[model samples]
Target: MKKLLFLLSLFFVTSLYAQVEKVEPTFWWVGMKNPNLQLLVYGKDISKNQVSINYPGVKITKVNKVANPNYLFIDLSIDSLVAKAGKFNITFLQNNKKFATYQYELKAREQASANREGFNSGDVIYEIMPDRFVNGDTKNDFVKGYPDGTDRLNPDARHGGDIQGIINNLDYISSMGYTALWLTPVVENNASSTSYHGYATTDYYKVDPRHGSNELYKKLAEECKKRNIKLIIDYIVNHSGKDWWIYKDLPSNDWINNYPDMKICNFRGTTVFDPHKAEIDAKGMSDGWFAESMPDLNQRNPFLATYLIQNSIWWIEYAGLSGVRSDTHQYPDKQFVSEWAKQILAEYPHFNMVGEVWLNYPSMTSYWQKDAPNLDKYNSNLPTIMDFPLHNAIPTAFAEGDGWGDTGMNRLYDIFSQDFLMANPMNIMIFGDNHDTSRFYTLIKEDFKVYKLAMAFLLTTRGIPQMYAGTEALMTGVKGSGDGVMRKDFPGGWAEDKVSIFTRQGLTNDQIEALDYMKRIQNWRKSNEAVKYGTMTQFAPQNGVYVYFRIKGDKKVMVILNNNNDKQELQTIRFAECLGNHHSGTDIISGNALNWTNKIEVPTKSAMIIDLN
Candidate 1:
């Protein structure tokens, strides 16, 4: 399947002795839109040598020697149109004579890698924190040289879940009607503590040995492809682990935002777009370190910026990724991210990437989307942004009673009323909860009625929907308890566990009910095109009943939410515009046929997903 099989295995080029310590992206693919390739050559006195490449269609455009003599930024121009999948000898010279030869490779890309269609509205994303999902292999729980280890008893400690764990659960996920999968950062987070989240990247080119190898990660993308599941990788460009290899040996002080005396960030993400914000405040938010263990990257540095951009592209190509979830999207230098996204899109036009814009208002969140018409003329070039505004409104919307003055169902109406402020409303990434937030089940006080209502609205609403892991089994944890509690291990993930979500064993009554409800709606959503790509038509809420219609070419799905206590109805005439000539329909959730001649009786604190006939 590869033009050059040897190209797959990349090692340090040892000509007599090892001179090239690191080269990233370990390997590159030909036919890339960008013809230039900058190889970060690191070794002892490596910059003192002359860089020369003896291969057709590959030329050393410029070899830049940095302040650190061990580092050399070798720029090579590869003619994509003329370059074939082959190897070239990059000969390092001392006094015009070749001393060391490093064999660099340009491999053939997978067919249509550039044209890969990303995860969109049609796919329901099931997000997984790999370390807490399942422990398919316990052998690599504690790899030598990796300081952290797993402790199942401690919520804050690692639970030993790995890539093989996710590979083992693909069928269960696919069977549940989740069409796409998103794994929180699998890049090496070799920190001493709290590294399971994977946001603090240590080695960009290597996968954490405890989690799995790069080979297994590629196998995951391949396996997911076989199951018709699109894979999205969580990426963070704002910072890296404090113990990163490059950090130990600096090419320049500007490589990191704040070097020896690092200042902590205020986390005022709004300052990036705040027109009236003070320059000092903006500097504190952007240039300051996210945490003591994480070093903020200086995107203004051309070499560092290119490293971040190339790393993402390499992952996308190597792992066969469908989409990217840019973590801490608002924390980075806006201009660098814009160019980073621009270069990625330049290479792959159809590729989709969502940013975790953790803003509570649509007006602010919309500013990060690609085509947002901001007065500053700064476009993020991001395809989608997370719906934090709607997420903030959901728990309160379902918890309170109706007609309580913007307290109950009216909360949802108010949020949707501001959709006009969004750049692309349909492209929003909506979710009930994620690894960073409190469990959705815990937020609504474990109310089954509210659970069903939230799930129904999420699946049937506009934009792409993302479900956090273990939501089906009614997983409960508050964010204040610590991130590890909210991202607890699944019952079936460990061998010694009494309950198994896979086999439906040892689950509580409420958990069983929640699982059944989740399975039913998720599986039903797969085949329904109206709910996926259809236009949404929502009627103004009246009497605590919020009604919306998902209408495609000919298919229609009517979703009704009754947030009141008892039963309330007589709403046929109000929805006649979307109901059309159909007088009857079946509720997808209850599987009961209903009449809609004059009025329909709606139950309290429940949702009805009707398929009109």
Candidate 2:
């Protein structure tokens, strides 16, 4: 009798260990062969659970554990499971008592494939801060815990732009000939004020409930792909919001870059590549806070680095993005950054990524590009970078000049001189204004002619062009010295708005002309092969007039910019080499015959493009 009691006690203990409390499943491998499918599962009190998966014409090869202690990884190594995809039931048991049983459905991997097809591409990328673009849906304008509601009336507050709004305006973007869209961080920003920009990430895995959802972003990619438009997600690896989820309950002390206490950075970006830099300076730059609210990430921690890298990969595989735009490029650990870029590119070889190295100097910027000859000889695989050197110079050149120093068109002269540092100039994204700066119109004090001239050069330039939202509409909202006003909502996109550029609802004559001109130039850029991949040559500036030509095998485009207000005329013999033996051509803008000879005439404060056929 005592021996019988001992055996019964052993059986009871085994039964208690195998009884699972609840099974919570997370990621579903949308589409895989029924036989080869691997379903990762998370459960509460499931350590010793007896699990079995059953399906018609399908078999489970094994069950295992993932990195987490509370996971039951289900693996099916069937070769013919793709054809038999439908639904399968699994049961978890303890002794003879059933603990849990549920049906798991197998659906084709539509979302995963969407992410793969939508984001990888070779095209010009336009980055938009959705909240500042247009308000297509105002129903989601307000949420609890955040009092700054939709304020189309306030230029500094939420403008009510959402995913649906972006969807509504796809035609306008597509009409402009842009092949891809890179939106700023759109995850749920639960901050009390100024959360409209969506940069301060509160959660890494969850989409900011305000913008939409993880699924909506996938839908955005799907919508874009149908129209041949790729999506480039703007990612921030440098820091998170002050109240990030991990901040309250970190997995480990080293999970964050500079956790527990915030370390402010010196804003010294050059130190990352400086060979003689002090160890403390480098550490501060990588682990320092961008601002009081922004908590910097410490990528040096192995787990943190791996987590960030895997998260980035998950998004890429999840969203099917055409590319990625890394924010605060120099703030993260440089070694880890190299690994991040390498792993990302390794996963998707055709995918391209551009880093934001907001430096005004080319020498400082070139150190971040891939294969650049560095003092440290670091080989990074990041493919592209923002052209800040050129971006800054264009405005200065168009602005009324000092006639000396880095003034007048010489600003353009000095900026392009550094093009030799770039491995591929075509991949460089050139822009006049972005979400973080004063609008071009505001910067030039709303001068229409200056804005036109600036647009002409930006579209015809040698880099991938990125125009800020509302730039075409001549929207002039300045966000002050800190760039709070640079991003304003599009008129008439919301129900309360009075004007709409799409239908020309409330535009001035000048605004209409500007919008039409932008459409024309952008579409022209999309089709012009010479402009896309041609050799460029420029004649020296004369009285603020700069002339350049993009030449291919037999295709040549002569671009003439007149920053001065006075018009000038001359014979066309100056560009004989580039002009070839042709004596006549057509001005694309004016549609007038151009009698090529010793010199050519250009209008003052105007730009002309000559189509040499």
Candidate 3:
């Protein structure tokens, strides 16, 4: 009879309360720069309970219960200086009776984690769209209830390129002299369609099972470390997938902007900084949903703000990432995103994060960089901004010969004249083409000479250079047909592929030559500090020839682009300012050492790079 009574009591306790459904961050570490931490607790009727933590140096500063009965935002003051790495119970009670208890752990951070350096100008970045890269595992091709599954024939569907795909190709990647790898979002996306892009995130903490588990992602980072490659994650904070757990059951209506009757964003980054802009225009850019499936986040909501910020920190720590590439960076709340960057930098001092400021003009892109002299006194605190202005100008410059206003080489050099608008010009990231655009070869009408000229210019330019995966193979696609065509599968990534770019099997002569040329230049770039860190000096367009010099303390390299149809004799006397006391140099491209006699003959539609002696 006593045993029956004890069993009945145990049943009552077990049935009455379950462990808190979710504790975001699940755990945290001691010795963080910020002593305060906000934990978003989600569970059934969780708001009705009183919360208490029993841990040394861990104090529950405040417990916030929103309109939702299932969500609790608990603020804790973690005195890292005194907090020991251990676990303790966080008890939830109702009517002074314990109902739920969660055991949370505080961990010890990795040594020197705070001092980890981010990707910079010294590194050449290889940008990849993972789903189209390779199929590393077939088992994860179709995750149950994920909506989108592997379909190689369907350009918009997932193709089963897991993190293991990236791990398996580290050799090919590093062999191309790429020091940093930037992949589009690998986070979980449960959207019904076109989920291969990975921008809409359903789960922030978990890597999409379709891509592989979060552990596999960390393993990818570890493998990259073995090969001296830095991993940069493409992170999105502006909005989340409509299927996101938080979006489905919002903690509060304001957690997401324009929740039920959401409006589309104006897609104008200028609205954020336009002094004469209408309030509606500014709000439209910030509050409007990025898309029907991407519900915009309200960073103004302190709880949501803390959630996003903490998530960024969590991923950086958990994955050991070198940097973050924030997608749709200009769409979030102004002041809140500023603070978001502030907090992340406070934790990782030397870290670098580039904003995706996809503006048409340099002024617009520069405005979001770390320090721009804006009339409105706005500072984005973003370490780098994509050089869209230059990327837009390059193909046009290479494709068109001597022409009017900002045409030909003029279009290329004219963009740099606006450099005064940039606080740090070196922080810009330049790319000839990316996943969303037409390939460089396609843009140049498949002119191999022009392709080499354009690539040589981008590689030798003043900013950090990022090359999209298939650029070297001269992959061709036009952007107007849609992103699907623009982001085609990398040849030979799958077993069924007829030809593999990986092994140079059955490649066209142009494709093989382009690949070898890019490999040569990129490998050489790895050793040339002048091109990476030197001050750039450009010469005015002279008869379809553009010249530039990258000069360091005593190191100098000269780049000449001949966009003409005839061989041109470039007078050396005109570049005396850049050629101080040097009469001879080795032309690295041809491996020919030439002694200048006031002029050098450069082939038409070709690039010449000289290492000064």
RMSD of each: 4.0, 6.6, 2.0
TM-score of 1: 0.96
Residue-wise C-alpha lDDT for candidate 2, range 1-613, written one tens digit per residue = 9999999988866654444332322233333322344444445645456677666545677776534445565665544443354676677777956666656654445443432532321255667888877666666788777676877657557777888778888888898777789898887677777878877888777676667778988888889988888888888888888777555544356656566776789888888888899989988888788987887877876556655765676676666778888999988888888998997776666678889998988888888888887778897678888888887777667886537666788778777777788776667778888888878788778889988888888777687778777888888766564455556667767776678877889899999989888877777777677777777787767678788888778888888888887887745677777887877777766668877556677877888887776
Question: Model 3: clashing residue pairs?
Answer: none
Q: In lDDT terms, how accurate is model 2?
A: 0.73
Each model's total of backbone clashes: 0, 27, 0
lDDT of 3 by residue, 1-613 (tens): 9999999989876654465788998789899999999999998999989999888899999999998998999999999877899999889988998888888899899899999999989899999998989989989999888878888888777777878888999999999889999999998988888999989999999999988998999999999999999999898889999889988899989988887898999887788988899998899999999898899999999899999999999989988999989888989997887888889999999999998888999878888988788888988888899999999899888878777777899998999989999999998899989887888788889888888898899899889999999899988889988898678899988898888889999899988988888888888889888998999999999899999999999999999999999999988999999998899998878888979879989987889999999
Q: Could you tell me the TM-score of candidate 2?
A: 0.83
Stretches of model 3 off by over 4 angstroms after superposition = 1-19
lDDT score for residue 469 of model 2: 75
Cα misplacement distance, residue 564 of candidate 2 (Å)? 1.8
Worst 10 residues of 3 by lDDT: 12-21
- Arranged by lDDT with the best first, the candidates are 3, 1, 2
Predict model 3's lDDT versus the native: 0.89
Worst 10 residues of 1 by lDDT: 8-17
